[model samples]
Target: MGLKWTDSLEIALDLIEEHPDVDPKQLHFPQLMQWVIALERFDDDPKHCGERILEAIQLCWMDEAD
Candidate 1:
């Protein structure tokens, strides 16, 4: 299952708060950048941050359905 939207948003914000140097907008273009984005996007929504990152990574995967 996909992560809750609030969870995603929280992670994104945490990356922003902790690093304070990484740019969030650049994340959509690169794999590493995307990881950073995911971290920032789900850093404060409960305690499933790790799960949120995994879900985000899977979202980029190309499946047989596609």
Candidate 2:
């Protein structure tokens, strides 16, 4: 199975690898969603993403960044 909307940690890890220089703390949901959708392993419906899911992804990314 590929990455889904619920795969916050996995997505975050991919984001860290894909955008090592990006500051997750400064990203907006739209941009975050866009990047997630563009990830190589991402395989979810963009329409399924919501504010809470995006927040979770961002938080995971920030946590891993530290």
Candidate 3:
């Protein structure tokens, strides 16, 4: 199975690799969602996304960057 929405660390790692120049702190949810969907390993339902999940992804991404 592909990565799910709950795979925050994996997703964050992917985001970090894909967007090396992007600062997660400046990222907005819509763009973040789009980016996540664009990931080759991502296969989660779009409707499952929410503010809390996005926040978790953002936090994980930030941690990965640091």
Candidate 4:
């Protein structure tokens, strides 16, 4: 099965690998959502996403970036 919204670290790792040049701090929420949905391993419903989940993903991404 594909990754879910709860798979924050996995998603973050994928995002880091896919967007190595992107600054997580500068990523807009809408763009972040788009990127997340675009991930090949991501399969959760878009409607299931929310600010909190986005924030968690963003934070995880930032952590991975460092």
Highest-TM-score candidate:
2
| Candidate-wise lDDT, in order | 0.42, 0.98, 0.95, 0.95
Q: Write the per-residue lDDT of candidate 2 for residues 2-34, one digit (tens) a residue.
A: 999999999999999999999999999999999
TM-score of each: 0.32, 0.98, 0.97, 0.97
Encode model 4's per-residue lDDT on 24-64: one tens digit a residue.
99999999999999999999999999999999999999987
lDDT of 1 at 20: 59
Q: What value does the lDDT take at residue 36 in candidate 2?
A: 98
Task: Give the C-alpha lDDT of model 3.
Answer: 0.95
Cα lDDT tens digits, model 1, 1-66, are 334444434444444456455444344434533454455333334343354554453343212113
- Listed per model in order, the count of residue pairs whose N, CA or C atoms clash below 3 Å is 10, 0, 0, 0
lDDT of 4 at 1: 95
Clashing pairs in 3: none
Candidate 3, residues 1-66, lDDT tens digits: the string is 899999999999999989999999999999999999999999999999999999999999998899
Candidate 2 residue 40 C-alpha distance from true site, Å: 0.7
